[model samples]
Target chain A: MQQVQQQTTSDPILEIRGLTQNFGGLRAVSDFNVTLAGKQLTGLIGPNGAGKTTVFNLVSGFYQPSEGQILVDGVPTAGLKPHKVTALGVARTFQNIRLWNDMSVMDNIRVAQHYRLGYGFFHSAVRSKRYRQREEEIAREATELLEIFELKKYADEYPRNLPYGTQRKLEIARALSIHPKLLLLDEPAAGLNSSDIHELIRLIRWIHDRFDVTIWMIEHHMDVMMELCTHIKVIDFGQTIAEGTPDDIRNHPAVVTAYLGDDKI
Target chain B: MLRRYSVHLILATLGGLVVYLAYNEYLGLYYLSVLMFMGVNIILSSSLNLVNGYMGEFSCGHAGFMCVGAYVASVLGVWLFARDRVFGAPVLDPEYALYAFPVIILAGGIAAALAGLLVAFPSYKTRGDYLAIITIAANYIIISAIENMSAIGGSRGFMGMKGVINAMEDTIYLPWMPIWVFIFTIFSVWVIRRYVSSTFGKGVNAISQDEVAAEIMSVNTNKIKTITFMLSSGLAGIGGGLFAYILGYVNPGSFNILKSTEIMVMVYLGGMGSLSGSILAAILFTILLELLRPLQIIKWIVIPLVLIILMQFRPEGIMGNRELGQTFPRLKKFYRFK
Candidate 1:
């Protein structure tokens, strides 16, 4: 709850400078950069295999960049593991919606708060007051988060049993369980129906307004991005081609060419 | 809060009853040995369950840790507390053995845990079949190392712990072996049950489910693996200590690949991710082992054949990741999430 508490600051919540990732001989993400301010819902759009997911991987600490630095709240995360990066107030959902599918939906969310737990193993073994207090708090907070996503009904069910859209929403809810300052969504709307997309857009906007977190999403759906994102960045072949407001990105020559396969625009 | 305290109270009373029965000779020697075997299997299977079941990693070399614990405890028992045929007189008088017994067992656990690090660190870089190989190698290495240690009687193996256990008996008039075995068995299950139910323990489940997602969610997968392995191996060490005391002798041959396989069979039979299942399966497995003693070498063949048939019919094992409470509605009231 302390992490979700709003702190007004002029500083950007995330700043990636000269980030580049090379997988063997191929340059997957070349010199990618972005500065995300707190509470901003930004979009990153590109064609398939445009290194968008690779960029997400690098920023999220799934892969160490061959070149560049990622600063979360102005701290370097070059050598840190993904979990350590997450502990520094960054959380992410996968492109394929990776939830702890065997665990109940409520457990999926509660498990994300592993680091936030203050009690030691001995304390829990003895069922000390501190363990009971912390556990009760986690259960309460997880249930509240599930309710926000309209997932209270499925709390006892495993994530694998949930509908696809609900699973996606649950993944987002799990990410939010970290009470992170920054959230990275990789292809959030990749396989959703249009109605689900609309609901997702509404949910994203609601989250941007309600939670004190910066949101950077990789979305293939242009309508969702145009409808929800305040700023948009376009990439092609691992290179950033344009960055500006959604309208500006939509009109940029390189951006239109990258998506439509044309330079005459 | 009252329910929690009552649970502990009930457990304590039950434990007291079992210890009392064994100490007073109300139970025959053969039955007592069988009960003690059940306790050791409970410790072994449940500890292995922490890694292979709850953590969702395959480790087949668990007996190696048991060997380490058994040897360390045996040596320390002779050197510090008791006289022996091979090792001569104790460095200290037998009067101190009642206190020294636990310290020796704990030392064994610590040593086994240190040995566990060898496998745990390598596990970070590998998984599945490769991890299995690593664990197998670790098992062989521990056995071979012990066999080669001439100072500890090498391949002839060592015998001396009977003197130490007897010293403890002389110090306190109670049934030392059964009582200690009972206490350690409860401690093992309690530690594991408490672990898998806690928030940090949930990280182990998360790693088992999806390592990448768990990492992005701030579950330290590497650290969790290390801790789980150490805890698992440490408990196995305690089981080994109890085993050495019960047998009054130990050999590298006793803690071999076959021993590890038996523990693995118990884990799968119990079902993965269910602590109660592990405990139940261990009891049944120990009983089966006892019943099969007349079968000689044929017991191994029959055991695996039964396991194969069981896999065909119910591949998830008896509990199949569901606890006894999940299957029986009447038992639900007694179920705590841990």
Candidate 2:
């Protein structure tokens, strides 16, 4: 962990210390610890039921931890709601592509800026000068975002109407609209075919290079993990089994047992 | 800019025409009252649509907030502008009632909005059917609370809002109730439209579609839910205030579960999340109610049957989720709803 911290010069964006979460008697995640800094791409991987998604949920403030602390930019996010946590410069995508299906694609991007809309209900209802300027700004920026992501053609279309791969792309675009310092991608390649997976890899790499965001992604695809992640952490049954470079993780005995079981079996 | 406000211009002209006809006695009292009720229904349906359609919360107790508004506005109007049996002499001159009526109605709306917190607070942890039951209970609690207050006439009902209208009429010799109803109806719809179009307001839509995703995406689900419920209930309160003055009386029995169900029917009939559809449904539903008045008790049975048939044929309602402009593209040239 200290060696990982030494690799990056900037201060840590996400610092988790002894995080633990229990769903009744079942321990979903326990004693998880990681310190991510700068703009490095990190990956979390494990077999099914390895508490991978649970860790993402904990970091994103969706689930309160049983014990431990999470800090975003060194500000404690222990009791903050998800939106408040997001306001501290964190954004995430779901494993299941949880875009607002009924809303138009443009709205999906626009609504992510809800935390910084800069106006209140009265401003909106009365359409004050401030409201007009803010709304116009939001619209212009949302348009620009869609253009950059090459999704402007589907601006007026609903998310459910978009193709599955395009929907995933749109979800990532929506997440990026928040301008988060730390971006959490949970299973971005979950349902994509080979070509879309290739496209996703390129998109993720481009986004990491272009957006200046520190990305932490969870993926089952070993190639995606190996290709994109500078560092990989493996967990099984809520326990951290391996942590190192992708090459080290690919050959680590504990990781292999966690994924493929032991040779004796 | 002219095209942007063309819809407002047309609505204003229609409102002015109605006021002119009513003031001249060219429109009879029956028609005037029917029009006033239509306005009230418009306020009710569109406001309820904000919660039920836009926010996607099953709030079946909308009338409870309306009842709170009706009583508050009625009592305030009487206490300030007219002599009341419970409150004795008027605090202000009756002559001022004409200008102060809107303030009284808005006060009622504010009160109803505060009352909406009853449901809004519980909504953070509960949703769907569980929230529905809480809202239904809240409706009962509100009605029962008023029924137990003997100072306000309790179950026997409350009166004196008629005197406020009469005072306004004496000052200006105008159709005060109809004009006020029309103004408030338009006002509520405009407020809802502006709210739902703003980025801040789109949080309501985000919550309805997927709340977890909404919260994680930086949409403050709780704040948005609170605002939506309050706005929805506050508008309904305005409708209730107008209804009280229109009938010159208010009874707790009038704002019961049946009344709430009527508003819900209007919301679903117009289509969820469509402002134009809600307005259209409110107008059509009000007219249908009046037309079926000859059936008296049978009207209830007929209304539900119609709703059943509507659900069977088009469960998404007349507009589904699209606005009138989206459905009829030609309307886009005449008006921009956003």
Instruction: Using TM-score, give the best candidate's number.
Output: 2
Give native contacts recovered, as a fraction, per prediction: 0.82, 0.95
For model 1, what is the alpha-carbon lDDT of residue A25?
A: 95
> Can you give the lDDT of residue A107 in candidate 2?
95
- When candidate 2 is compared with the true two-chain complex, its DockQ is 0.88
For each candidate, report its DockQ versus the true two-chain complex. Answer: 0.72, 0.88
RMSD of 2: 2.5
Instruction: Place model 2 in a CAPRI quality band.
Output: high
Candidate 1 local lDDT, A55-112, one digit each (tens) = 8888788899999989888778889998889999998998888899899998999999
Model 1 agreement with the true structure over B52-73: per-residue lDDT tens digits: 9988889999999999999998
Scored against the true structure, residue A34 in model 1 reaches a CA lDDT of 89
Q: Model 1 segments beyond 4 Å from truth? A: A1-8, A263-265, B1-14, B334-338
Per-residue error (Å), model 2, residue A110: 0.4
Candidate 2 interface CA RMSD, Å: 0.6
Q: Model 2 segments beyond 4 Å from truth?
A: A1-9
